[model samples]
Target: MYRLTWFATNYDVNREVNNGRGPVDFKISKGSRDKTLVEFKLASNSKLKQNLKHQVGVYQAANNTSKSIKAILHFSQTEYLRVQNVLRDLGLSGRRDVVLIDASPKASASTVSDFNQKGFDF
Candidate 1:
């Protein structure tokens, strides 16, 4: 998705890029001095806390960039709560650099009669 979004732009987006320390999920660079790292994780991952604490920092240092984004996807309310707790413990509860995506499987509003009666058309 990142690649597709930045396809016509100057930014170059690569996946699983290894810069000696380890492989980060995605690396976006416009030039040698312009770069950002993006890492994706599941809220249910066993090492969610550890990764949220140290993984992105390590990747940033390795890639020689201070900018980074961490995206986490949760499949359920339980998993979302777990992620929230971990983020709060790490003092990153509402940081913009951290994005939480709720990908839980649920009925769409368009398919719900309540939404239809409310004049919401998907």
Candidate 2:
């Protein structure tokens, strides 16, 4: 969420902005310019495909901006692959505004298990 906070200094950042169609997770703008709609989702969300195809476009239109961004976080390999398919289906695979963050615990996360077995808290 550091990026979101960082964006606030130059733009008016609004949360859960409803534009008659649905709520946009974030609406960012600098005065009357550079309006950007941002939506976030878990990669496991079943409605991800549907929303990306139609809902985001409508939000951009309603917000009167041509720029929009979608951020998805994946908690597993399965979720990451599913997002790839959906991005291809929506022709957003190459779009710069669509962002995917891998949130899965890394293999390194278990490297500490050996230390834990020795009852070390640090």
Best by lDDT: 1
lDDT of 1 by residue, 13-96 (tens): 999999988899999999899998999999989999999899899999999999999999999999999999999999999999
Candidate 1 scores a C-alpha RMSD against the true structure in Å of: 2.2
Alpha-carbon deviation at 10 in model 1, angstroms: 1.3
Whole-model lDDT, candidate 2? Answer: 0.87
lDDT of 2 by residue, 1-122 (tens): 63567553866888889978888999888888779888998899999999888988898888889998899999999999999999999888978999999999876755665775778776
Residue pairs in clash, model 2: none
Q: Model 2: which ten-residue window has the lowest total lDDT?
A: 1-10
**TM-score, cand. 2:** 0.80
Model 2, residue 36: distance off in Å is 0.6
Candidate 1 regions exceeding 4 Å error are: 108-115
Which pairs of residues collide in candidate 1?
none
- The alpha-carbon lDDT assigned to residue 86 of candidate 2 equals 97
What are the RMSD figures for all models against the true structure? 2.2, 4.6
